[model samples]
Target chain A: MLKVIAQDFIRHEFLETVRPLYQELVEKTRQEKECVSYHLFTDQKDPGYFIFIEEWPDRAALDAHCQTEHFRRLVPLIDSYQTREGTFLLMDAFSAAADS
Target chain B: MLKVIAQDFIRHEFLETVRPLYQELVEKTRQEKECVSYHLFTDQKDPGYFIFIEEWPDRAALDAHCQTEHFRRLVPLIDSYQTREGTFLLMDAFSAAADS
Candidate 1:
């Protein structure tokens, strides 16, 4: 499986303005293939920071999703939040005990 | 194994200011027991966005890491970037084939 994770340290003052964009991207990612799950969660301990988790059947499928129109539009808006700074992570996963 | 991922959309302008902080973190996390590997990567397609991937031996070790002093300090400095808006993700991983 392929797992991709990212956390954004957004400006707290702009939190309300970004909610609609967050909601739109979440909905769009869920509709894609290999997207087993996608969610946006806030840190109870950290108010403005958010995390995004996505799981894919394999890397190729994940690559395809990255090229989608939703991804294209989402990237720019997401970048807008980079007014402060954020990060992106790409991970290749190997699991030892699937049924454990 | 346990997997944890996060992405931070750092302000492009402050990217250099956060470099020392990022380096300090990579070293600290690398020394932990469950950390098979942790890397900070930039999106080739996007600038100013960063991703973090962490793998642990199990959940217990991960839980401990969270309570560690490194985590306490890391959280606050990271939150300072919330000038725009960001995210955090917590995932429970189930693998079908670890030795595959």
Candidate 2:
């Protein structure tokens, strides 16, 4: 299995404006065939910042997600209120045994 | 081996306010025996937002990291910031196959 983790920061005030749209996109992402899990989180002290953590069965699943129409359609909606584009600046995948 | 993924977001302006300190903490984390990788990324379009992605060998290693003095000392320094407190908000761990 391949696991992917991505992060992005956003303005605090933007949370109110983007929460609804974010929920829609997350719902769509969660439904994807390869999605193992997906979620959103906000900083407790810093309300402006938020984070999204995702897990996929493999790179192929993640790649397919990138090509989906739902993913494509999200950009414009995200751009309207976002001050900056989120970036997957870090990427790593490797085989391993379960730690437990 | 167990892979741990964590995500947290910070405001754009706060990015600068905390970059130096963040880098120090990350450096300390990377030196831990179980760390496979650690990184920080800023939004391409948004100056105020940033993310930290981490990978650890297992829960034991990750737990030890939390107890380290560097980790302990980081709190008060981080608390001095203006807006909100950062949160680990999301954490996931599992074994995996290399998806090359």
Candidate 3:
């Protein structure tokens, strides 16, 4: 499994404008066959900062997501609103056996 | 609910030392009545860096967690291994209707 954590610090002015777009992206992204989970979180202290935590079956699945029409359409606008392109960290998950 | 995303950049030298402590912490934390979920992830590109994603029923639950003997014992050691104290972000989660 591939876990992706993306931290996007958006310009305060764009918070309201981009929220709906994110809502749509989350909805559409979850329907993809490769998506295990897709969640969106906003910083409580700074609403403009959003974090996307997602799980995918593989890199190909994630790549396919990036190529989707909604991704292409929405991501650019989302990017434009950010102070930086955003930070993406790919991770390997670990869990204690007791919890697992 | 209170969701916490903590990013820790551990000193490469301390990776081996902290792994077991973290594992123990995760196990103990999940056993707490107020803990909704707890997950640990290590950055693929940088094994020394870790991200902890956690959920608690409320502030009291979180505060109680901070007071745990295991938490108190392990966290300081974990913090000592980091280059910087680490960045913690409190977030409000949002999900698409299709998902919910």
Candidate 4:
């Protein structure tokens, strides 16, 4: 499985503006057959900082997700409000036991 | 609930040395009553980079986790092998729907 930790740092003023769109993106993404799980988290100290913890079966599934209509429509719009470039860490479970 | 995204940059030379310690830590931590979930991941492109995605019932549970014998014994030892100080982001779910 592939786990992605995507960090987005938005300007404080844009927090409310970006939240619903993120909810929409997450809801749409979760419906995809390739999506194992998709969740959104906001930093407790910095509400403007958001993180998406996602799981996919593999890289091919993840690549396909980026090409989906909702992704294309919402991601660029979401990026426009960012205070800085986002960070995406593509990772694998450190132990096989964790995969379960 | 509190979710912690911990990023650790380990020296490449210490990867082998740290793997078992991390495995031990994960195993022990999962047994804690306050631990909702705990999983470790390694960056796909950078073997030296590891992340711990942990969930606790609350801040008190997380604080108690730090006081545990296993945590006290292993975390500092684990930190010693880090190339740089780890990044710990305390986070909360953006949408209640995702918490399920």
TM-score of chain B of each: 0.77, 0.66, 0.88, 0.92
lDDT tens string, model 2, B2-100?
333443454545555566676678878888877787766543444333445666666677778889888788746755663555545434321122112
Off by over 4 Å in 2: A89-100, B1-65, B68-100
TM-score of chain A of 2: 0.73
How far is B90's C-alpha from truth in model 3 (Å)?
A: 0.5
* Tens-digit lDDT string for candidate 2 (A1-100): 4434454455655656566666677889988878887766554444444456676776788889888888788746666665667655323331122112
> For candidate 2, what is the DockQ-based docking class?
incorrect
Which numbered prediction scores highest in lDDT against the true structure? Answer: 4
What ranking emerges by TM-score with the best candidate at the front? 4, 3, 1, 2
lDDT accuracy of residue A29 in candidate 3: 97
Fraction of the native A-B contacts that model 3 recovers: 0.77
For candidate 2, the TM-score is: 0.47
**Candidate 1 vs 2: which has more DockQ:** 2
Task: Compute the lDDT for candidate 2.
Answer: 0.58
Please provide, for model 3 over B3-78, each residue's C-alpha lDDT reduced to its tens digit, 9 standing for 90 to 100.
8988888998877788889999999999998899989998888877789989888878988999999999999989
Q: Write the per-residue lDDT of candidate 1 for residues A31-99, one digit (tens) a residue.
A: 986788776655545556666766778778878887999889976786686456776455543221221
The local distance difference test score of model 3 is: 0.85
Work out the iRMS of candidate 2: 13.8
- Per-model interface RMSD values are 13.9, 13.8, 4.9, 4.5
lDDT of 4 by residue, A1-100 (tens): 9999999999988777887889899989999998999989999888888999999999999999999999999999999999999999999899633322
Query: Considering summed lDDT, which 10 consecutive residues are worst modelled in model 2 chain A?
Result: A91-100
Q: Write down the TM-score of every candidate.
A: 0.47, 0.47, 0.91, 0.93
lDDT of 4 by residue, B14-68 (tens): 7878888999999999999889999999998988899999999999999999999
Clashing pairs in 2: A12-A48, A45-B84, A45-B85, A46-B84, A46-B85, A84-B46, A95-B98, B11-B48, B12-B48
Using TM-score as the measure, name the better of candidate 2 and candidate 3.
Answer: 3
B1-100: candidate 1 lDDT, tens digit per residue: 5556566777776666666677777879888877787766555444456667666787688788878788789857965864555554444332212212
